[model samples]
Target: MVALSNVRFGKRNDEVKAIQAGLIAVGMNIPAGATGFFGEQTRSAYAAWQRVLGFTGSAADGFPGCSSLAELGARAGFVVDCRNPGAITKSSVRFSRNSGVAVDEATARAFAEQACDRTGAPRSWVTGVSNGANLLTLVFRESSFRPNAVNRDDVNATGPIQSDGARLNCSRGYAQVIPDTFAENHQAGTSDRIYDPVANIAAAINYIWRRYGDISRVQQANPHRDPAPY
Candidate 1:
């Protein structure tokens, strides 16, 4: 980390000089007689390159401070790692043309279809078919649709109920639960679906009776996870 830090600030070091050279080679628009300081001008150029690749972050100073730039570079076929601090970053796009996510249109369609099947949602509601499809997002974002990823360990939760970090307690998977006492009381119904995407999806649609379902309670039973009464 320190080695790269020095490389970023050197005035006469050729390696540092080389970095500035590459930045200029790609049209950095530096000031006249640039002294290899890796200053604002160079940062602007780096930031511009990052934007071209759809990264989301700022380029302040010249350190590439563990921001969106590193991740952007990584996603754009670069082995760039933010944790490494300063190191020689290489772009995968430069050497290997056959890189990037492997998912293709056909496969994505199949995956979407499978996701819909698992959710038991109408085939017409699937993407490219449904008017407002949300099954895929629910599976991927909230639960990863994998029972193993339920995140049973994350206990320091601020939200009412969380299925790990993805599915907020109030907002159930795919359903986007509303935060309310009644909503929280309904969480028990989802325990069975802790890892079953299909079951979880079905539970969301049931939206069992809320206001009228349990009027004899201190507050409305947790509506999102209300347990059945004996």
Candidate 2:
């Protein structure tokens, strides 16, 4: 079985190798031949497979979605696990309010860039704002670039307060993720603390990838759209 989480871009592991083998088996050309590294060649091949599977536009953009990856695995004789243990229902989170001092745009961009790097998401998400899709905009809307921001009145506010003075499950940090969300989606090498800017943003990015497939599809990440729960 292959976990969908290990099949993203920039990942290097046995699962990526298995995915490459599957793609190659399906007549997608991966010249490196199951190298266990997911680079441009593998992404291009995966995108081709997506096209073969009738996905178009951004849906065929090489980032593996559960359905597409699972189909590939089915053909390759491997089971795909699409479960996201970190996922929390939108009903459990409320975009109540932001609390904490706001940081400047430059600082927020820097943090977001670091998060993109950690999560293997495109840095363009932070550096560029095409089609109103921008990570900075999402951070600004969620917490106004506040690294320590907390939303205390939401449904997730039931736990005892922590060192940051907010309840344990209250949304916190630049992306305002709850502690459980942060713990489940935390990047491998990042600080465990939810208040850490890069860690928080990275977890949010991973969660976005798992839930929405891409940041552009998230309403909160698009400046032109009304702020919505993601």
Candidate 3:
């Protein structure tokens, strides 16, 4: 799901149209048929839905928060939970990650081989010779370090400001990939799961291959040219 707007009464925007559609789909009486405008009727229906969801007073003041938008989206046949690593396929949701998902030995080997082949990195190093294993081990260690592990949330994460003085929010996923180097590099999934091991590893490998070309290049680069803030 894309980022939802935090909309309330008196605001008129394109996001309001999605909200109106969701409200109407959930059986709300949006008589104007999803007008981009937020009027009294939209507010009343939204408040009533909020009350039904057990919120009262200010909490039910017809303002749409993330949770409320998610619930509304669910009712409208959309899956809005960013944490769910699942796909809409074959008329059912297929979960991509399970309790045991991780950077197993096989996955690491295949990833390294692919990276070496794609980037023309030395076969020995890409196959975990010298400091190559260290890179692979970092992902493994991070994925094993927490209960959520690879599913760790990277949304709203911040890294130390970069040399260019941009307060980069590029750290993400099990490999903690910084993906600003490529255009439209995001995987086809929810935004928050940029940290999921499968997605993170793929994105990180691609970023490394694209940005630094090969591990040897990264090793030879000036230390002061580090892109990572940490």
Candidate 4:
């Protein structure tokens, strides 16, 4: 285990840098110019990591406890509970993609709720179609980066829709917001903020809602596509 000292804003140490590196390695967004100093930016990034790991409220406070440090260090996959962060299930979206292992029902439900909340779809709609719809995000996520990452080559890309014929100049974060989508839907920010999980998910849901209306419609439109079982 990497021994890390308790850190808060204003501390400067290699451990702080290590923490930043760990979080970044796991797809959390630390500033590109992040120095070894623990500042508000680092704390905010840390909190975002906690949120992904299913921590919320006081538990989501931007502090690095031993467990959080270990989680960062381990680089194990984490699941975000849309119900709340209080009940996190450790599942790997990467593993499911790479190994063809299906995500568990709980994770599917979480994704269903999260997606529905943004689209104003009924919980039952997602639950009914969660088996297939969840896979779209999971499989599509394979082509996506963490909220902080972008394809180096595609950084300058601008397109409204992602397609094979056109260069896929858009895709980042969990939901993979393409350039055109970002221009139309994003709140206003470029670079790292576009990769923010909340921002990306919101943009993704918005895109999906605008295109498909609801989860059931999404399934209807893409009947042959299959990523996992419900």
Candidate whose lDDT is highest: 2
Q: How many residue pairs clash in each candidate?
A: 18, 0, 1, 3
For model 4, how does the per-residue alpha-carbon lDDT over 107-205 read when each residue is reduced to its tens digit? Answer: 434543665454334455443453345423542444332333444355545543332233345455455555456444443221224444444554554
On residues 63-99, what C-alpha lDDT tens digit does candidate 3 reach at each position? 5555776788778755453321222222121112235
Cα lDDT tens digits for candidate 1, 1-230: 11222233223354445555555565555664345565556556655655654555322323343343344334433333222121112210011111232333343335445543543334443342212333343334444333233342343123433424442432332222222321222223233332233333333322221211111220112223333321
What's the CA error at residue 207 for candidate 1, in Å?
45
List TM-score per model, in order. Answer: 0.25, 0.72, 0.33, 0.34
Model 2: how far is 98 from its true place, Å? 15
Candidate 3: regions farther than 4 A off: 79-230
How many clashes in candidate 2?
Answer: 0
Model 3, clash count?
1
Better of 2 and 3 by TM-score: 2
The reply for model 1, stretches above 4 Å from the true place, is: 1-3, 7-12, 57-230
- Give the C-alpha lDDT of model 3: 0.49
Ranking by lDDT: 2, 3, 4, 1
Clashing pairs in 3: 173-195
Candidate 1: deviation at residue 163, Å? 34
**Worst window of 10 by summed lDDT in candidate 1:** 89-98
Better of 1 and 3 by lDDT: 3
- At residue 201, candidate 1 shows an lDDT of 38
Cα lDDT, model 2, residue 8 = 78
